[model samples]
Target: MPVRPADIDLAQRLADAAGAVIRPYFRRPAGLETKADQSPVTRADREAEEAMRRLLDAERSGDGIIGEEYGEKPGVTGRRWILDPIDGTRSFTAGRAIFGTLIALVEDGWPVLGVIDQPVQRERWLGVAGQPTLFNGGPTRTRACPALRGAIVATTSPHLFAEGDVPHYMALVTAASGGAPRQGPVYGGDCYNYGLLASGHLDIVCESGLKLYDFAALAPVVEGAGGRMCDWNGDPLTADSAGHVLAIGDPARTDEVLEALRGAVDDGIAHDH
Candidate 1:
């Protein structure tokens, strides 16, 4: 059967519910807690997940839900909803505007609907499995940068990227060729940067130390907008495990960027280990 396009009405509804849950908590203190990894969390994360779950049951009653806070719940629909209620909890807790909500509808493990709502940013980005992305309900796609010399890249933790992520980071820096690659370390919004890439505002976004919820929503958005997103080995992403993602408007150019980054990171890892 043709995958066709995912249901937009359903996609928007899910994104909206997540956004609605976070609206009141935007910049409001939600009381933070420390996870086992010492990462920050807040009531907003938990509350947002709960609210989304309720809507999922009512709207797509049979769909399985995989969330950040509550983990996976029983669902019967062939489609699975992968969500990160508040991706940038650290930023959210600190009252930064970089945080946003990520949701993706996956059919048989492939994301066919991706929605990224940056409520505080007042931007709602979404796209179904085989279509272009929409920003605020308008058509959108990544900007083309033919060469790596001038690509601009974003990453969450540059310093921590040194250990295992060195190859991926190095590939990015070299791919820039001559274009300036800027790094202003900002935490949270793992999916937002991919949204930015889909909108033609960014060249690449790298991620490591991510869970399925962290990258699921983002994979579809970036890919839907005429870009390619995958782990370091060039595998398509799913809602699981920690891996590296290289997102760019053009695949050929992105591959060039990837090769350069891989070499650089390989050298760095070789030196360190």
Candidate 2:
């Protein structure tokens, strides 16, 4: 079924709720802890997700929930709400405004609506399936880069990638810059990079080690803005995806980037022995 106006509206409200809770903790000394994987989590992340969950439980009790802080809460409806209260926790802790709150509604395992809200920047992007994306109450479109060469690329950080994955990522950076390191593919945007891609300021974002909440809201926003988002292997992103994500502002470059990534994988494997 097609996404409805109400779905989009609800998504906006959800983001707003999360933002209200998160903004107060931003830049302040937050209680931080390391998760099992050594990633950071803060009070801002927990409180924001709790705020959104409270709102969802009251408004749409029948919908399921998948959150970063808390685990899944299943409901009778096949539809689920995915929440990433703080997409760039490290950035938030550092007093950077690049972090965002991601909210998405997935129906029967497919995202139908998404919202990327940067509360500090007061910039929000809302996307509904089969419709144009709205950037801060106005329509937005992705810029076209017909080829991988010279295409601007951004990733959260190279440290997030596994040790074995660095060679593959370096290959992508080379392809994006035509082997010119200074031309393109700067680092450190996280989820904000995807928003930039939707707003025509960026060309590509490739990252690995993402969870459902990390990427659930992203595909719709990128696709709605005339871009394409999928796994590095060029498969459609889903709950079952392997967490390697590739988002491109211009769909034409999808195959080219994928081929480069595939070649990188092959090269890495060949050298493993």
Candidate 3:
């Protein structure tokens, strides 16, 4: 189904609402708490999501909601809104401006619209399927990276990767650097990296252990900006996709990135055998 202009407007409104609730809490003591997973959460995270949810409750009640903070609310419409109020809580706590609010509208499992909002910087990237991505309402495109050797790869952190997934990430990094370490993978940007990639500042971003809310909004932004986002196996992202994600700014480099990851997995399997 085609996304309506009104829906796109609503998405920006959702981002606006969340940003309002988050700004006052940034850099100030916001009553932090740790989730069971040992991840940090603050009042900004909860209230930002709440503010967005309240808007959805009033404007698009029929749309399902999958939020990082309050859990899920199923709706009758085949569409759902996936939200991550703060993609990098640690960064936010550290007073970094890289944290972002992610909003995605998925229809029947496929993301039709996505928004990456950085409240502090007041920068927003909006992407609708089949349309060019927009950064701050201006059309943006990913930069052309001729080869993996020159690609600028990024990830939130190496420690976030599971032990089994580490080798695959390392292999991609090694390949991206052409086997000689010359400025290792850029680390720690969370969703901001995707926005940068959309605006042509980044080349690739690979991550593991992400959740639906973490990545559901990222694919459209990356792809609409002349990039490609997929699983490590090279499949398009869906609601049911595994957490492993690879974002390549240049579409031509997809196979090279996938092969690097595949080679690592293959080597691991051979070693186990």
Candidate 4:
């Protein structure tokens, strides 16, 4: 079901609160710590998440919360909020403006509303299921690209992919370039890539090994902009979806991209043995 406008407003407030806490730490030397997975975390990530949680607790205490910095907090209501306070921590630490705050509302295990806020750049993209995506106070839609060749796909990095998954990803990259090199899939955007895809700047994005908080907010943003986002097998993304995700700005190209990616799935599966 579609979220009410008031709830969407609250989601915006959550993003704003997170941005306030994160902006001061960006580009500054933060106390960095490594997680068990070896991914870096910083004070910015923690404090920002705390800020959003504080607001959620006071306003919608009955809603569940899942955050990157903190552990999950279940609520009586079936609805939940998923947060990545600073989606591109590396970019923020590097003083780049590509970092964003991701806020999502998932009800009954499906995402229904989302926001991608780039605080440094002062750009915001808001999406509600079954409604037009809004970009900085205006409705936005993605650009159309009917084929993989010259589609301008993006991924955060090949390193994020598993050893067995890299070949499959490269196949799609090759398909995008049609075996020739002329601005193929660009790298290094993180959540910002999805916002760009929604605003008609990027055409496709594929990534693996994402958590619910990592990907939940992106689907509504991409889909609300007249795009389609699904798993590698072209299944609609849900709370239980596998980490592999594909977002295509042009709805017409979803099947083609999925097919190209699937062509190497057998190789990926075999290599995993």
Instruction: Tell me, by lDDT, which candidate is best.
Output: 3
Q: What is the lDDT of residue 232 in candidate 2?
A: 69
- For model 2, the local distance difference test gives 0.86
lDDT tens digits, residue span 86-185, model 1: 8888777777777778887787777777778887777988877767778898988888887766677777666545356655575566556343335332
- Candidate 4 lDDT tens digits, 1-273: 559988998999998888888777878888888899888899989999999999999999999999998979999899999999888788888788998999999999999999999998889999899989999989999997967788888999989886577777888888888887777788898999999999999999989878899999999999999999888877888888868888999989887887787687564322110
Q: What does candidate 3's lDDT look like per residue over 182-257, in tens digits?
A: 7578999999999999899989999988999999999989999999998887889999887888889999999899
After superposing candidate 4 on the true structure, give the runs of residues whose Cα lies further than 4 Å from its correct spot: 265-273
By TM-score, rank the candidates, best first: 3, 4, 2, 1
RMSD of 1: 3.6
Order the candidate numbers by lDDT, best to worst. Answer: 3, 4, 2, 1
Better by lDDT, candidate 3 or 1? 3
lDDT score at residue 129, model 2, on the 0-100 scale: 88
Better of 1 and 3 by TM-score: 3
Model 3 residue 68 lDDT score: 98
lDDT string for model 2 (143-229, tens) is: 989778898888998889755766777788888888675786667877899999999999989888788899989999999999999
Instruction: Flag clash pairs in model 3.
Output: none
What TM-score should be assigned to candidate 4?
A: 0.96
Instruction: Name model 1 segments beyond 4 Å from true.
Output: 1-6, 159-162, 174-189, 239-242, 265-273
Off by over 4 Å in 3: 265-273
Q: Candidate 3, residue 100: CA error in Å? A: 0.2
